[model samples]
Target: MEHIVELVGRALLAFLIMMVIARLLGKQTIAQMTYHDFVAAITLGALTANLAFNVQMKIGHMITVLLTFTVIAYLLMILALKNRSLRKWISGQPTMIIQNGKILEGNMRKLKLSLDTLNQELRERNIYNIEEVQFAVLELNGEISILRKPEYLPVTRKDLKLKAGRQWFPIELIMDGKIIQDNLRQNNLTIEWLMSQVQKKGLTIAQVNYAVKSSNGQVYFDRYDDQMPNPIDKE
Candidate 1:
């Protein structure tokens, strides 16, 4: 029982320490994590696990090591942000694997990427044929970025000589029956105005599952009960 209690306590402490270190390292999505970031993450996880499970190891020494790794990782992040040359040296640069509808075999070989893998990545991007790609870059994070040929690209409103109106992101005023007062203030809306809009849809604030104000000054509401008949023909 005593051993179990010590293990639990250690685990909690390690978790809190890891959380603090992660926050200090800043935020980067999995897709955005470069080679150095990946190494640091793995090292941190191993250290944290050891700290949690290895009871014989001195907790203070392990914590000091963890903090040292975090500091180094944070410093590297700062250097990467300020120094372009150092960033390229540490994280590497994006390599062009495809150019002008042709696969660069030499670059692909240098990156240790197989032609099959390249095709698979291209297929994931919805380009089955390499001929459709004007340019393709292998990002440092191992994701492929593709630029489709002009003829293969989707036609936009600009290409059709059509005028496009200004667009705005929708602001959530109410989510899951909870009022978002900050969103209301941001959009210069009031609780009274929101209640009125909810009433217009035959719903009270409590009945609303989601409520958003669109950029075009339109209030869109969805209720908890979605039993309303379809307005459009299914056929």
Candidate 2:
């Protein structure tokens, strides 16, 4: 009754506060989140979450706290954008995890990334072998950006003296144990051919991890293996 009403009121105020503060923080602040940004997000969530359970805190009190944080966060964001020194201080420069096909043991130790963790991230970026990486940077946002050895990179038109056209995304023909008939039709492929191809690989549609159609009239497939070959033969 009365307790429920009070709880509802506090919840509404907390919601309003969060909405206003999030609006003040620009989209990029939320989008390209760095380590500090993640901390701030957690802090804000905890602050609001407590408001609902803590009867001692009033709606106005929560709003004031929210306003204080919003101003500080917004001012710091502006300063970071306008002042290069502040930006560098607030968001530390990207740390080179690997360079020249060699892992920086000191940097890895400093970042607290174990060899196994580093290897996992590399694999996610389609880089299985660390020796193959020319550069591996641990971004401030905790994302690993990789640059592979020149030999491993795609052969550009300049490299082979071949003409290039617009690069296009591949369409998924089957996903999650279901036939994507629309995609098959769009790519001018048939279910019978698809089944035949899968059977050739000793696989069924259930075993396929991905099926994508490239603009070059090629269909690619991947098994459950993340390390599977690219543009897997549909034949």
Candidate 3:
């Protein structure tokens, strides 16, 4: 039990020390991390994490290791600041993943970035189609930056020279076959009125998955299972 407690205590200390070092390094150390920064962060974290639980590694040894690495990192960063070429080498240059709506196959190969990985990243950024992108850059720390074509970008009210701030909000009328009285009262709607609207869509309160009132004064309706039978029934 004492051994376990010691292990936990050492782990906590290691985490705290690393956290302080990271905070001192500033947000740019991770936010706009270069390849070297990324590698350094990971390697340091792994080393500390292992040292925390490894009984063979004393706390003094861990501190010594951390201090040594921190000094080295500080020196490297200072040198990098002084020398542009060193900075470029340490950080690496951003590779063009896509240019002019086409993938740079050579860059992709060099970076070992696969089509699937690119698509996944794009999807996370709400980009559905690759052709919609004008430029895609792979940063040194492996993050992607996308620039979409004008046509692919969502149209803002400013584009049409319109001052429209009164955006529409949807009101929840029902959820999971239960009448949301609070929402109904908030929207100045009644259960009877909601039932009448549901009937218009050939649906019942029991059959509705969600019923919502749109800002355009439209009542949007959804069935519990629109395309197929309820999966809950299968279970």
User: Which residue runs of candidate 3 sit more than 4 Å off their true CA positions?
Assistant: 163-235
lDDT of 2: 0.81
Model 1 over residues 1-235: C-alpha lDDT tens digits?
A: 9989989999999999988887777677244789789888999999999999999999999999999998888888888889999999877899999889888999988999998899899898888878899999988888899999999999999999999888778899989889999988987889899889988888898888998988886889988888878756687
**Candidate 2: minimum summed lDDT over ten consecutive residues — where?**
223-232
TM-score: the better of candidates 1 and 3: 1
Q: List the residue pairs that clash in candidate 1.
A: none
Best by TM-score: 1
In model 3, how large is the Cα lDDT of residue 180?
Answer: 89
What lDDT is reached at residue 106 by model 2?
Answer: 98
lDDT of candidate 2 over 1-235, digit per residue (tens): 9999988988887788788778778677688786556666788888898777789877678767867777777777888789988888876679998999899999999999999999999889888877889999998777899999988998778898878877656777777667899977976779998898778778878788877667774667887756656866787
Q: Please give the lDDT score for candidate 3.
A: 0.84
Ranking by TM-score: 1, 2, 3
State in Å the error of residue 10, model 2.
2.0
Reference-based TM-score of each model: 0.91, 0.67, 0.62
> Which TM-score value belongs to model 2?
0.67
- Candidate 1 lDDT (Cα, whole model)? 0.88
Residue 27 in model 3: lDDT:
77
